[model samples]
Target: MSLPLMPKATAVWLVENTSLTFEQIADFCGMHALEIQAIADGEVAIGITGLNPIAKSQLTPEEIQRCEADPDTRLKLRPAESHLTRARKGARYTPVSKRNDRPDGIAWLLKNHPEISDAQICKLMGTTRPTIQAIRDKSHWNSANIKPRNPVTLGLCSEADLEKALAVSQPRSSSIFLVRASEASALSQPAAPADTGHYGRTEPQDAHSEAESLFRRPASPAPAESGTETDPDDSADF
Candidate 1:
């Protein structure tokens, strides 16, 4: 039998764009709703293995074949496993109570690095605005009364601070990854001009003109009669 054309990206896109519930999507994609939720939340990484036997009815030949063909591609297509399930199956996860619940380090970052705003701190810490505020407010770690501490001392500023420091200290250089010497070497060589003919002009093209040209074409002439004569009734005066 011919295979169906369903893909994992399409499935995820449908889930995001459509109002379908996890259960409905799970039923449609031959996966458990819980598993689908976990995948959506990025708690677990999906694998190439097929869904439970109960969900096999939803599997199409194309999806199965694609899953089997590539392990990485198949992972994208499958639902994520639950954290509880993974842990039960011997996967390690820090317990909620033990999960470094304190935000003192974040507060230290904000207080010491006054130049950086709460929003900047939030982006650097990979957290929400409210969470950052909570840290600043000392709601989580009671850091308001805490002693003077730099982000480096709290482990929140090393990576981000290094980059910021480099940007401020160094001249306008191209290579952000390598040392100054390497960047200077790279800057010495000039880059070749890009070929613009194949891609049209570098400047923005007029959308209206492009669309009009695409849809509009010259009309074709009508074909002349060969041996057959035109009917008198059909003939028109020139």
Candidate 2:
């Protein structure tokens, strides 16, 4: 579930402004009931300002009233606004500690993924074209000390954002290389030979019968012809 922007502050507001029990507020804020009780007892968040979830469109007044009426029920956060209709915003903010590491991330992107465009780098790293160019040319103020590092490892950009940027910034040459590699792989394999019905010890039935008949012995001559054509060589004794 999407949470209110400042949960502790919202808990403080609920505790100070409403009579809802600690459990309800804790459930809504994703905090422990004992922690809410500590806030109620003035043991935690001593001087923090409370943020109104209702004012921020993160909660509804009617939902708050229903939860106030029933102590056992949990509070639900309002549904998020659709990004499809939401207007695009400016560049994201980088923390003070991580600002110096931008050059390292930029240099890494330039070296490793030169196909990525400068605009994509800017959007992903919260940097500008000049900074990217300076880093690429080794002309930045800290170029000497800057070492290429992953923006994700440095906490400068998310993996999702990096993937999205890569999708948008992929060079045409890389695609051409992929296509050529696939074609080469396809051409290297030999084609399979066609299947023939003839296999081991197999032939037409008519041809097999004709071949067997050719090997048959000839029939002996009749005994009557022996008496008319007897010769001295044919008799057993002369």
Candidate 3:
């Protein structure tokens, strides 16, 4: 699906030009409501030049009005023949000047958002896994001079894209941890009644008994392998 170009900028325009709620603006612009609120409060996107969606033919004034009239309604993008022409997907292009800053951006992502995997970084930054690995290992050619800088600030990617990438990566990580925790809980449980049987019959063991069985120590060592003679005094009890 086609999304608004420069979504943050589009959101800025929406916030400044309309009375739409942050949720509505966020939904239309593919951003967090909090981020949209931040834009309205001038806490972020401070120096960003707003790009008018209507002026760019990405939206119509009527659409904005319709959404404004109904707080629950979402703004829709205006269909354009140009969006169809631009459907070809390929590796993203970085300008020659901005290309050198990728290592810094990669380093920033690695240091700040280590929860995101190498593959997610590759997708978000339009960089290769090898490059990300090198940065993580401090083995990149310019490692000495590399500094952690936001990829959005470096112009390597947009904030909206970064947020979306993080949203995708984090849920999967949480789900994996949840699965592992559930498996661990399952393993910790005592063997079932059917499992405790010697001949596959149901022979239940109580919780305390089961735990004791698992932790029971070995029997006292056999009497010196039936040695010839023990000192008579050694057999005397204290």
Candidate 4:
């Protein structure tokens, strides 16, 4: 969807002139609903001039009314007559004044969006892989001074570029999470018990004959001839 030239101003105008819900106004302006409420409460954007979308041909009066009648409906930006193509992306130069702040921006991206690739961060911040690696390993010369701050806040990258990189990395992060979950679940299950035989060794099961065991008992020795001494002639056949 096309955003207004001035989102905050447009939000202000919508808050003042229309009965549209905060969500509807925020959706149209590409801003948070809380921000729209702040504008209404005079807490933010105190002196900014409101730009009327109707005058800019960015909205039609009828469309506004249609949305005003139904709170669920969202206001749409009118398409421009000549659609301009987006400029091709290329390596960007960081201004010297903001170049020292790149490490801080890199730190923030590393901490907040680990799923995003170092290459993506490099492209977004006009930085290099080595710079990113230093931050990641806490080996940068200014590591102690590097406080994490948003790349956008540092004027190192645009929100759109950061959002696009995160979107690309989302699927990869999800797949990794799923794989880890499966491994954890497998480890949590109890192991099957092993069967042991007579000698404390795993033995194959077989049919046992209980009758054979009962019949194989050794016979008792005959009672010794008591006091029937035949002394020296004991060797003679009796």
Write model 1 residue lDDT over 1-238, tens digit each, in one string: 2211233433453344444456655555566778767767766444322222113223445554554455344322333221112112222233355224326545555655545555455544445677777665557445455543433333343333435644543443333335767878889999966545455665325798668778998899999868988777777553
Reference-based TM-score of each model: 0.24, 0.37, 0.43, 0.50
* Residue range 133-219, candidate 4, lDDT tens digits: 989999999888998987765667655567788999999889989999999999999997677768787654443544555567788
TM-score of 2: 0.37
Q: Name the candidate that leads on lDDT.
A: 4
Arranged by lDDT, best first: 4, 2, 3, 1
lDDT for model 1 comes to 0.48
Better of 1 and 4 by TM-score: 4
Give per-model CA RMSD. Answer: 30.5, 15.3, 13.6, 11.4
Residue 160 C-alpha lDDT in model 1: 34
Best by TM-score: 4
Residue runs of model 1 more than 4 Å from their true location after superposition: 1-102, 141-149, 156-238
The residue pairs found clashing in candidate 4 are none
lDDT of 1 at 80: 27
- Better structure of 1 and 4 per lDDT: 4
Instruction: Give residue 111's lDDT in candidate 2 (0 to 100).
Output: 90
Stretches > 4 Å off in candidate 4: 1-90, 192-238
